[model samples]
Target: MENTGSFYNRLTLQALAIVEGESDLIANLSNISALLNMELENINWVGFYLLKNDELVLGPFQGKPACVRIPVGKGVCGTAVKDNRVMRIDDVHAFPGHIACDAVSQSEIVIPLNIGEKCIGVLDIDSPDLSRFDQNDEQGLVSFVTELQKVL
Candidate 1:
């Protein structure tokens, strides 16, 4: 298998190319999911929860069964969407009202994906290691999301 960052670097470039070509959103999301699973090391889950209508519905993901419906202000994922900011949790258990989709997950980083200045979805990543994400990830994810929004 490819090294984690190497995988993300490859896929991120691919996604950028697709965005430049104005390709499909669903296909883009699917590729993102695959990239997260393949690029991020020791991750239990990585995917998106897209806001549709008024609720957050599950989008393309690379993991086991996840919570299908998340309200506007529920778990870490929900709270991120509701707050419209990145929520980086070193320990999910410590976060109040954290919805435990997988008990094995220790840390999580959720970035709100915005389009046209509207919060449309969330990019969520989970890892089994404590403090799996940091400022670097936050910056990298922000850049990635910025790139993603160009065509969405």
Candidate 2:
């Protein structure tokens, strides 16, 4: 995926435009999940984990069944929210308290979904290959979240 940053950005921006002016959260998330699933390569899963009652609950996703709930400060998705930062785990197995929602998922990226300083959820993507995510992916995904926040 050399030089894919610009392409991804353009694609995500166009995808977001399609959902612009639509105020339904679930509908927007569902479309965004589908867009990621279709656009990203070598990815096993793409989805959202919404924060509810201080816990992460599985939201719109395009993948096999996943864990429904993860406590705040627990697992990759939770940690991203707790830290209010993006997490790109090169090897999920090496990470402490890693949640193995998919046995084939070797690497993962979790981007916190926030409204101002308050985290409301995460955009979680997993891959079957190790070291699948890097700083570039983090930056691109962060931009994706920024666009998403506008519609949220």
After superposing candidate 2 on the true structure, give the runs of residues whose Cα lies further than 4 Å from its correct spot: none
Error of 2 at 37 (Å): 0.2
Question: For model 1, how does the per-residue alpha-carbon lDDT over 31-72 read when each residue is reduced to its tens digit?
Answer: 878866876678999999999977889999999889998898
lDDT of 2: 0.91
The 10-residue segment with the lowest total lDDT in model 1: 2-11
**Backbone collision count in every prediction?**
0, 0
Tens digits of per-residue lDDT for model 2 on 83-144? Answer: 88888999999999998999999999999998777788999999999999988888888988
Q: Name the runs in model 1 displaced over 4 angstroms.
A: 1-11, 18-22
Give the TM-score of each candidate: 0.88, 0.95
List clashing residue pairs in candidate 2. none
Q: How accurate is candidate 1 locally (lDDT)?
A: 0.85
lDDT, residue 24, candidate 2:
90
